[model samples]
Target: MKKFIGISILALLVGFFSANAQDTAKNVTTKVKESAVKVGDKTAELASKGKNAITDKVYKDKEGPNGETIYIDKHSKYYWIDKKGHKVPISKNKLISKQ
Candidate 1:
């Protein structure tokens, strides 16, 4: 009778450990899925911001008041032209120095 009781207790202990391991695996899988979703959202937001920055640069170069033209040079710098058709140099140092 003592031997039978010992075997039953061993079996119960084994079953309890197996159940606990399965619960831990399930929690880890849930956490990984949530982290993957958050990373995907951040990637999409960064791509959208990059596209908007390009569009804004193009719009600034093309749109202006009547008889005035805005130009962006190869160095990604900006300048303006007036109605008098004169070549005016805008000071890049002054523009960049401003906070």
Candidate 2:
């Protein structure tokens, strides 16, 4: 009976420890994913800025529908860079002139 009690206690402790370890691992994974997303966003923003500066014209006195900076591509197409670094095309009439 004593040996059985000891084994039961050991099993409970092991189960608790394994559950705690899984929680810690999940937390770590979540944090790592968050960090990766942040890094990717920053990298995309920098790349967009660099590409725009080199390959497009920045409309210093204008903005987009969401108040984003405006860029005119080689084809005279107006656009704005979104958070994911994609160009959101806009009409020239929709541009907001900055004061």
Candidate 3:
């Protein structure tokens, strides 16, 4: 009877450890996926900025909100690059003139 009890206890401990390890592995996988998404977004933003710098015309005396540099694309649409490197459209009335 004592031997049987010892074997049951050992089986329970093994099962508990295996369950704990699975949870830890799932948490690690979630963290890695989040990190990969952030890196991809940053890379896309950099590529957008590089393309705009090469293809758009810059406005030397005009500024955008928060002092962002203005640009005119091939379509003659005025815009400014935001912190995330997205082009934010602006009207002539909203432009800040520099002295």
List model 1 lDDT by residue over 1-99, tens digit each.
Answer: 999999999999999999999999999999999988778776765564454345434324243433233445556665554323332445444333211
Residue-level lDDT of model 2, residues 18-99, one tens digit each, is: 9999999999999999999989998898899789978999999998877899999989999988887888899999998887
Each candidate's TM vs. the true structure?
0.54, 0.89, 0.70
Q: What's model 1's lDDT at 56? A: 34
lDDT of 3 by residue, 14-78 (tens): 99999999999999999999888788778777877778878998888888867878888999999
Better of 1 and 3 by TM-score: 3
Off by over 4 Å in 3: 60-69, 80-86, 92-99
Error of 1 at 8 (Å): 0.9
| Model 2 vs. true fold: TM | 0.89
Model 1 earns a TM-score of: 0.54
RMSD of 2: 1.3
The candidates, ranked best first by TM-score, are: 2, 3, 1
Give the number of the best model, judged by lDDT.
Answer: 2
